[model samples]
Target: MPDGNGTFVKDFFIVGFPGLHSTYYFLVSAVLCLVYIFILIANGMFLFMFATNKCLHKPMYFIYINLVLSDVLFSTSTLPKIIARYLFQDGTISFSACFFQMYLVHYFGAVSSYTLAIMAIDRYIAVCYPFGYHAIMSNRNTLILSIVIWVFSHPISIMMVVRAFPLPYCGTNTIIHCYCDHVSITRLACTDRAPYSFPAFVFAMVILLGSLAIIVFSYSFIIFAVLQISSTHGRLKTFSTCSSQLIIIALFFLPRCFNYLAANVGITFNANLQIVIILLYSLLPPMINPLLYSLKTEEVKKILISKLKKHQVHLTVLS
Candidate 1:
């Protein structure tokens, strides 16, 4: 029987890992709790630094701030409930809440994809047209672009959720993966899901490959520009500037592309293996990004050292 809201199933169960032994639940939950804590402390520190430090207000940092926000919000939306599930053996989520989580998962994902593309653009301009880089990628323009990325990411994500949410999910109410997402939720639809699934797949590919194409194109130009530089040191310096972004990009995008492609194609993965891969790509980047920025970017590194020195002095004075 359908509820007043027309959902046949009023809630869904999020099974973190179907095969896990009961004895190890506490261990798994504790590890996840630590990861969540690290993500917050790392990203929150970067956010605080950016907010207080005006010298950090450049186009690249502006784009990074957007990425940081998306990373934090995404982690927040997904981590708590899953942690609770393992900690308390409670995996239940209400109908509306499940869909809301799905929306946020996709929304932040889309934002991250676009932000990475914008990051590539920032680097492309910096490397290829050094003289005009500042003029082209001014703070105001970068902020506007960040706003546009956030605004534009909503439509398709909302449509994916809206299209999938109203479907008849009268079958099993257990979501197989760690978090609520479109595919996991829609798999339970009572009706044939081909029509719905295909469109969602297309939208996902467009977001992933579209942004990926931009990154690829921009880096192609950057490579050409770097090669033309006469001095090895000049080329090395330029490449070093991009190394962190490239590392983050590879971590975030490559595994995701492989997973999406593998699923759509005939290749199959073990259920646990698939879930682990998803977690690797989804969670690792956010945890690693702050460290990458602090270590790789010279300005950020210098400022961080300065702040640490000041803190040390304050501690010494207090003692």
Candidate 2:
């Protein structure tokens, strides 16, 4: 499937959305398209609701905005290519184009991981040291910290693309997944990938497990603090904030652990299994993040309700 260029080539492949009746590609495509449409509209509405509504502007929601933005990037980076491949029988991407694809997908992924870690620390401070939270997480400090995470994620992702692309390709350049994933693409590399894979593995461990450890430690103390509170009401309020964060962190961290660990060890290459994990990775976390955050916060709910009522009124007047 490689194109005419001797150095690098990837012209076309039959990938994305398999295991339906041939008659159902059209139906399947329609369903996937609808899913994608809702993802954009719903996530976009959350982003808009957060940005314009001053009431929702706090350290938590500010972090949520970053999360939403990353999710939007995360969803778009792979899904469009996926939809394209299904709609058109063949799809082509140049070497450099593949590199950029790798960068965007992983870059935003790392961004999301880093942001979740930040959110965990934010909650830790809020719950553990309620009085000191505001002073510690000033607007300026949070802004600088966000910038640093993005800056840090870039070099690592770039290295991944640089390391993976130079390897020799024999015949078909088709990547099994819709997007060019770091590990899957590396497997195809003609050269040994220890130099690239090792560093990436280390980074993954630091970001995934390391973050999990911090979150666990923070929450352990948080649980202790909650138990000490005599009033049931106070404890419930505290748990609500921690609950949504816990859900998001677990979803993001677990698959990463599975992917890195499973691949490092010699595992069976069940194509169906791989596709399921990849789809869960690509789709689930981003889709659920906005839903979880919006559901957890009453402020967000009120704003959404108000917006809905106003829109309904407008429609009625027009009619």
Candidate 3:
């Protein structure tokens, strides 16, 4: 059936929000541009600081640098083309390019999930096993963990994309979402998508849920450890440190869970609303992570402040 339906789709039209009114495309495009700009600024700042500041090179920040890389790649994979699609009316993407985008879209996303879980594990060790934290999460081991996450998470996404790539996509060439992805691409194929779709969905769920489980498990122990602290001061301080991560986790996971439910359960949801949900979960995390994760750390905050002050002083002298 690969060629039974007709010519194989050589390219795909990224039909972002097909239901959206044409007149409002400008407004939507502007908003997307703003979010895209913020994502670049926030994540870029972290990467610059991490690379320039020798003191920032530690196990924790190593994991963060990895997240920054993934976020940059993730945003790059989707945003630039979508921006052009909106601003220039150039929505057509080559078939192979679309699949490659699908690979990176899923790969970096899974890497972020796994990287976050690694962060949670890092926090758990720091909180629960304070004495051995340094030895357990040594710089070398942390580097290895980050490398393993980048290396291994890729193949899982490859499996999902490979299954869909060979299927005959002879039907509609319009992708409903902003970018190429497993579900949107596979659903358009001529073949019975169940063979391809079901496994991919399950695999996606397993990655989502498994990483979330690890985070939850780590936090559970962290919470238990926090309770045993003797002073209210200690308890509040410990909990405060974790609050930002909890917010990031909720922002990233909750909307995604809802999107999955809406997709699979035959629930009638507005198409624009679905796109908005997708944007919220993916875009907000990277934009805010620099603040919530990096700046939240006292050491990083101090370093950033010192750097900013120095820059301001130099600017004043120049003026």
Which candidate number maximizes TM-score?
Answer: 1
**TM per prediction:** 0.96, 0.90, 0.94
Clashes of 1: 0
Span of ten consecutive residues with least summed lDDT in model 2: 3-12
RMSD (CA, Å), each prediction:
2.5, 2.6, 2.4
In order of listing, the candidates' clash counts read: 0, 0, 0
- For model 3, what is the alpha-carbon lDDT of residue 229? 96
As for TM-score, the candidate ahead, 1 or 2, is: 1
Q: TM-score rank, highest first?
A: 1, 3, 2
Best by lDDT: 1
TM accuracy, model 1: 0.96
What lDDT tens digits, residue by residue, belong to model 2 across residues 187-298?
A: 6665677777778778767777776787788888889888888999999999888899898888888887887888787775577677778778667777787888788889
* Model 3 Cα shift for residue 275 (angstroms): 0.9
The list of candidate 3 runs beyond 4 A from truth reads: 1-5, 315-319
C-alpha lDDT of residue 16 in model 2: 56
lDDT of each: 0.91, 0.76, 0.86
Across 1-319, the per-residue lDDT of candidate 1 in tens digits comes to 1234444798999988888998999998999899999999999999899999998988899999999999999999999999999999888999999999999999999999999999999999988888999899999999999999999999988998899988998767888899999888888898888899788888999999999999999999999999998999999998999999999999988998888777667698888888898988999999999999999988889999998999999999999
Ranking by lDDT: 1, 3, 2
In model 3, what is the error at residue 178, expressed in angstroms? Answer: 0.7
